[model samples]
Target: MIQIGDRLPEQEFTFITEAGKTTATSAELFGGKKVVIFALPGAFTPTCSQAHLPGFVVLADQFRQKGIELFCLSVNDAFVMRAWQQAQNADAITMLADGDGAFSQALGLAKDTGAFGGLRAQRFALVAEDGVVTELQVEAPGKFEVSSAEAMLKRV
Candidate 1:
């Protein structure tokens, strides 16, 4: 997996926001600002629903105060991403949809979620500034590790 000090994968992903939709590149999000981006296996799953997303949601304000943008990424479609954002009440975070798995693959963090029947994102977080990856946190499968938004905030 890619590590700290490595440049974050420069890839474009279409974010499926609840209000609308738009495409953003990695550079666009983190080029000149500090960014906290986490990847999830899939949206609406138990662990993700109750823990992963919620952690970020609750810490959004603190992150913003620290000049960080929080984002959550999944490999689902735009509609699913939007619905998940609404269902999870994640108003403070940007939900990005990696529908084609291209971005995740490019990051070398893509995973095969067998039961979901799809290539999905792993539980990972990257602290990026000025388009460079400053820190990286990767969790084991089925185990949420250093990628929690709170963890990232502490690192900052």
Candidate 2:
């Protein structure tokens, strides 16, 4: 699994913006930027929708005030991610689509859900500077805590 001091893997993520759909490389997003990135198993899931994503949405300004960018990633497609962002009123957070779970796999954070949802990202979050991980918080299965934005805020 990716850990502190490890650089994010090079990968492309699909993003839906006001302009339209676009692809951003990991370098483009994290290089020279202090970023707090969180990943969930899927979009519109219970904890993810009710608490995980909302916590970040509510704390986005604070993170930005601290010179950090916020990103929320999921194993869903770009369309689903876009919809979820809109539904959650999360304009302050950038939604990243790991459509095929490639990026999660690259980070060694991919979880095998079997028939439940196939391959998905484990619930986790990390703080990175200039593409290198500075802090990482991975949640225990079926539980939520350390990876939440509130928890991250205290650490970052």
Candidate 3:
């Protein structure tokens, strides 16, 4: 897994924007910015929809007040990600689609949950300053803990 002070991999992420589907690299997204990135297993899963995403949405302004940009990433397609974002009313968090799990694999955070479905990213939250990680919080399998928005709020 990626560690503190490591630069985020320059991987592409697709996002369904108002204009349409768009692709951007990690550098384009994280370079020269202090960003809070949270990766979840899937877009519409119970824990992610009910708590993980919502916590960040609720705490969006607080993060912004600290000059941080918030991004929510999932190993789903842009269409699914867009739908989930709208369904959750998470306008505050930028939804990123790691459609092929390339980014997750690069970060060494990919897990094969084939029993449940397929390959997915582990639940994690990290603070990246200008593309370099300042802090990282990864949840245990089927658990939510330090990676939460409230926890990150305290840290930031």
Candidate 4:
């Protein structure tokens, strides 16, 4: 698992917006910036739709006020991520698509869910400064707690 003081691995993430499809490398997103990144199993799922993503959306301003960029990541396609962003009215959050799960695997956060979903990212959140992790919060199987937006907000 990725730990505090470890730099984010080199990876590219997809971002779909009203303009068009674009790609952002890990370095481009985290380099020289204070960033908060939260990853969920999949997009549009119950827990993620109702609580996980919404929490971040609701507290985006607070994170911004503290000079931190907020990112919501998932192992779904760019199109789905874009739709979820719109559905959740999460305009303040930057949604990134880890379509291939490569990023999650690199961080040792990928999990197999059998029928629930093939390869998905475990629920996790981390605080990084200039590409190096400062803090990490990972939830246990079938649980949501430490990695939540409200919780991470207090920690950051």
> Pick by lDDT: which candidate is best?
2
User: 1-156 in candidate 4: lDDT tens per residue?
Assistant: 999999999998888898898888999999999999999999999999999999999899999999999999899999999999999999899998999999999999999898979999999999999999999999999899999999999989
Quote the positional error of residue 113 for candidate 4 in Å. 0.6
lDDT of 3 by residue, 53-139 (tens): 999988899999999999998899999999999998888888989889998998999999988969899999999999999999999
1-156 per-residue lDDT for model 1 (tens digits): 777787877777776553567888887877888888899888988889989999999889999998899888888887888889889889788888889988788889998867755798888998888877888888976788799877888898
Query: Which 10-residue window of candidate 4 scores lowest in summed lDDT?
Result: 12-21
Q: Where does candidate 1 have its weakest 10-residue lDDT segment? A: 12-21
lDDT of 3: 0.92
Candidate 2, residue 134: lDDT: 98
**How many clashes does the backbone of model 1 have?**
0
Candidate 2 all-Cα RMSD: 0.7
Clashing pairs in 2: none
Once fitted onto the true fold, the runs of candidate 1 whose alpha carbons sit more than 4 angstroms away are 17-19
TM-score of 4: 0.98
State candidate 1's TM-score: 0.92
lDDT of each: 0.84, 0.94, 0.92, 0.94
* Per-model TM values vs. the true structure: 0.92, 0.98, 0.97, 0.98
